[model samples]
Target: MSFLKEISEYKDTIINRLLSDQELCKAVYYADEGFLEKPDIDDLDNLIYENIFPHRFIPDTTETAKTFVTISCTDYRPTGNSFKNGLLNIYMFTHRDLFRTDYGYTRMDFIMTKIEELMNSKRGIGLGELGFGGLNEYVVNEKFQGYVLSYRPVDFNR
Candidate 1:
């Protein structure tokens, strides 16, 4: 299959799988809000829900039950020959306020940890047939409390 088509399918698999989890659904915004200014922690309760998009923009930000998760499927520059491998970058976004807590672990930590675990676990079940390999790694951003998942589609031939 074409790498582009395979990556899109893999993204669909991820979105569908994550949306199935009730706990994740409550916290996850299912869209990226990179285009807008980050929401103020104080005003997080005032956001509207209609503006969220899969690439950039999540509008709901209610506190205590804030939808702070944005899942974006991004494309990176090909690392080698273009015909064989393709990378997909998935980002998980949350407010920086979620990075620190009385519990010492923080909400972002929990979410990012759980997400990486879930994605890796689902690799052979829900995602395996999509021609995707296991996650390369997940990283936490210093400023945004966002987690990034890097993955590759397997066996794309010219």
Candidate 2:
């Protein structure tokens, strides 16, 4: 399962995208928790190809440069009657997993240099050595601390 990648390996890929004219500031939206994924594929490819290839960027991203942005997955719930009635009252948020209620959350921060090195294959878990928990979440090795997140579920809507 080659899906996990190091966040630090995409520095030049990102910095270059940021400087391009394609506008890398646009973010990917996860309506549920209102999370924003920066460096959206469009932001990255624009630097090299001038447009997002195929479509939105996913966990196993392909386009470089655009991969430098942070993609966060968060959990949220209703806050008041308005929220319960679907009144668009986004009043609450937390570090919970959208699907993994017991273990759900995300922090996309990673080193710049690491991101560049990772852009080579777009395969394997973090650093190419880790485990993906059955729940489609990254499982940290007791000894290695690497994030094995290849088990990520497919986002059909994307």
Candidate 3:
């Protein structure tokens, strides 16, 4: 399978896993086109109180009403001289507050851990260890927490 296809499939698997929880059914998103404009405080309030769990800007590409987790390709490059060995980085996005609340923290942790497990265990996808090891933190204007993960697809020989 092509690397892009593998990435897409990997994303679909994650979306399915998250949606298993009824609350998160429509909370996940894929930000392939880039992020939506930052909403004003008024809009933020509307999105939050209106039962909009996941926040999103572009309703056109987003699957659900709100956006909880946004997945995007961070980086893709060769790890070795040959194109056979390469590293793929996928960034998972969510509200920073999720990491503060007890329930949210646990749920977020579960999702992240599950993603790593699924990637490593699924031989077909060829996901290897993260670029470093654990989750790398990134914040977007105090609103979003981006967890950047590094993975190596299995070599063709393997």
Q: What's each prediction's TM-score?
A: 0.53, 0.18, 0.47
* Local accuracy of candidate 3 as per-residue lDDT tens digits, 1-158: 56445556544554444444433322233221221222223322333323322222222322322234444443455555534434444444555434432343433454456556655445544444323334676444445555555565544321
- What are the lDDT scores of the predictions, listed in order? 0.46, 0.25, 0.42
Best TM-score among the predictions, by candidate number: 1
Model 2 regions more than 4 Å off = 1-67, 84-158
Q: Which 10 consecutive positions of candidate 2 have the poorest summed lDDT?
A: 84-93
lDDT by residue for model 1 (68-156), tens: 44345454334457444554555555656544444446555555666665665345322343333444323333334455565554543
Least well predicted 10-residue stretch by lDDT in candidate 3 = 30-39
Best by lDDT: 1
Write down the TM-score for model 1: 0.53
Residue 82 in model 2: shift from native, Å?
1.5
Q: What stretches of model 3 exceed 4 Å from their correct place?
A: 1-67, 71-83, 100-107, 127-134
lDDT of 1: 0.46
TM-score of 3: 0.47
Q: Give me candidate 2's TM-score against the actual structure.
A: 0.18
